[model samples]
Target: MPSVGIEGPVVSRGLDGDGAVEAPPFGNANEIGWYRGGARPGAAGVAVFVGHMDTRAKPAVFYRLGDVRPGEEVTVTRADGRTAVFTVERVETVAKDDFDAQRVYGQHKRGRAEIRLLTCGGAYEPEERSYTGNLVVSGYLTRTGTG
Candidate 1:
């Protein structure tokens, strides 16, 4: 299960790979689920969380993620009691192979905190190819609820 505070929020593994898997509003998937090629929070790299916009039967947890506009606020509570909040800076669509993990998850030169959200996008395939690309939401850290 994903980590959450007693009074904060709860997130669980999303079903159908749609990543309905929920964590704290902005928690990294690694802290909550099994993700390949990523490190834990505060591990000297940008943590990434990924989910699906929709499943065959229903929309995933991050279904509404794409609805978040730039300047929106996303709050993630770390296990250490430090809440790493992020402000949505940009949202972009990229082909699967073209999705650059380093560019998206690597540390920034400006020494600012950052986070990334990923999901399948760019047209849904019914049975063969499920998704065409990834919808990435990028943000930098800030105080919670402040955009």
Candidate 2:
């Protein structure tokens, strides 16, 4: 996402044994974790990516995610040698307690190749060492090309 000042490796990640989506390891704070269990970037379904907004020491790869706005473009380079260009549809900040997995990760419409970028946001809880909400950026595929 060079358009928004985000540049990093995209690591394929899977669910944990408890079925929870895992973030990139602490060692890879600059990496973006792509959910391998969902639709591919250009596929007709929702694809999700997660990254840390900031580490304990400094701002991470997605620190500027919330800076993005609607109508901007997000480009994804797939491992399969293809490029997916998506246009931002919306951006939201949902409280942790109000985080709806289905609504955030679910497909907005049948056969639409959508993508979501998630990161921690809202009030930071120093006691818990985590934020009170998550920032979600929604987009839909607008173009595709061979890499």
> Which candidate has the highest lDDT of all?
2
Please provide, for model 1 over 75-143, each residue's C-alpha lDDT reduced to its tens digit, 9 standing for 90 to 100. Answer: 766656666666778888888668665676666645555677776677776686577777878887765
Tell me the tens digit of each residue's lDDT in model 2 across 1-147: 777899788999998786756789877899999999999899999999999999888889899999999999999999988999999998999998998899989888889999999999899999999999999999999999987
TM-score of each: 0.66, 0.95
Instruction: State the number of backbone clashes in model 2.
Output: 0
Against the true structure, candidate 2 reaches a TM-score of 0.95
Residue 48 error, candidate 1, Å = 1.1
lDDT of 2 at 37: 95
Q: Each candidate's lDDT (Cα)?
A: 0.57, 0.92
- Worst 10-residue lDDT window for candidate 2 reads 18-27
Best by TM-score: 2
